[model samples]
Target: MSQQDPSAAPHDDRPRGDPWHAFGYVVSGVAFYGFLGWLLDRWLGTDYIVAIGIIFGAGLGIYLTFSRFNRALPPDSSHDQHEQN
Candidate 1:
């Protein structure tokens, strides 16, 4: 059996999450807000149009960003990459 060197540093093997999920979430949120705001404007007869859309879209974007950040997993420090035995 090969022994590990005491002076050598430990390795990390962790799966990094993809960033496209965030982009997709932001895009979807924006589209949803836009559609909802338009419907609200038509129903409420508000002179100020698209303001709600901008606000909600921005808010949803921020929410998505935070959600993605929180959901992302931290890097693994263990050198164990499992394979089917």
Candidate 2:
């Protein structure tokens, strides 16, 4: 058996670090909200709710995408600062 290094971080094998993930999130958001709006419209006899829901879903998706992808990360102390001895 090989020994593992305790200081090494574990590798992530998932493929979520891509732009497609954001696109999927946006599309799914829009579809889900649009479906909900369609149901509400059918129940309440409104014709414009689906459009409004689609727009709202798009806005929400954009906000979520930006929040997840455009976040400002803190400076890395290991590389940005030198240790003072």
Candidate 3:
């Protein structure tokens, strides 16, 4: 067996997970919030303005969620290392 170098940087072995999970969660969350807002507005009979606000809030939540996953890198970056050189 070949000896391993302790000084070398450790390699990542697991498959790189997608960063889009958060985005999906955000989208679902927004849809849920929007529905709630619409229900509340309809029940209170204050017009649809509150519903619109709820939609905007949902959009914001989606954006933030997607942003969180925007920086995700692949599990194996050997290709990246080669490209960098």
Candidate 4:
């Protein structure tokens, strides 16, 4: 008699997605930094800095993604700490 669709996800309490967010962070970071690096290279007439910028961007993006998604578990209550087995 269950009305729920069996083919759908079983849990309705699932949290929001992170894959797209992570992808966006990385792609945007690389693109934005790449552009800046390209501009800087043109201005300074350098050849290797663009690679550095891309690398930096990717690293920053990964850091951001992790920082955004990581969750700390809630601390146990004092009542629980004193509970008997």
Compute each candidate's TM-score over C-alphas.
0.52, 0.71, 0.43, 0.67
Candidate 1 Cα RMSD (Å) = 8.2
Q: Write the per-residue lDDT of candidate 2 for residues 10-76, one digit (tens) a residue.
A: 4433344578878887898899899999999999999999998898888888888877776665655
Candidate 2, residue 38: how far the Cα is off, in Å = 0.4
Q: Put the candidates in lDDT order, highest first.
A: 4, 2, 1, 3
Ranking of all candidate structures by their TM-score, best first: 2, 4, 1, 3
Candidate 1 has what TM-score?
A: 0.52
Best by TM-score: 2
Clashing pairs in 3: none
Per-residue accuracy of model 3 over 3-70 as CA lDDT, tens digit each: 87885766655434455665565677667777777787888887675567667767777676656645
CA lDDT of every candidate: 0.68, 0.78, 0.67, 0.79
lDDT of 3: 0.67
Error of 2 at 60 (Å): 0.9
lDDT (Cα) of model 4 = 0.79
Specify the highest-lDDT model's number. 4
- Scored by lDDT, model 1 comes in at 0.68
Q: Give me the displacement of residue 47 in model 3, in angstroms.
A: 4.4
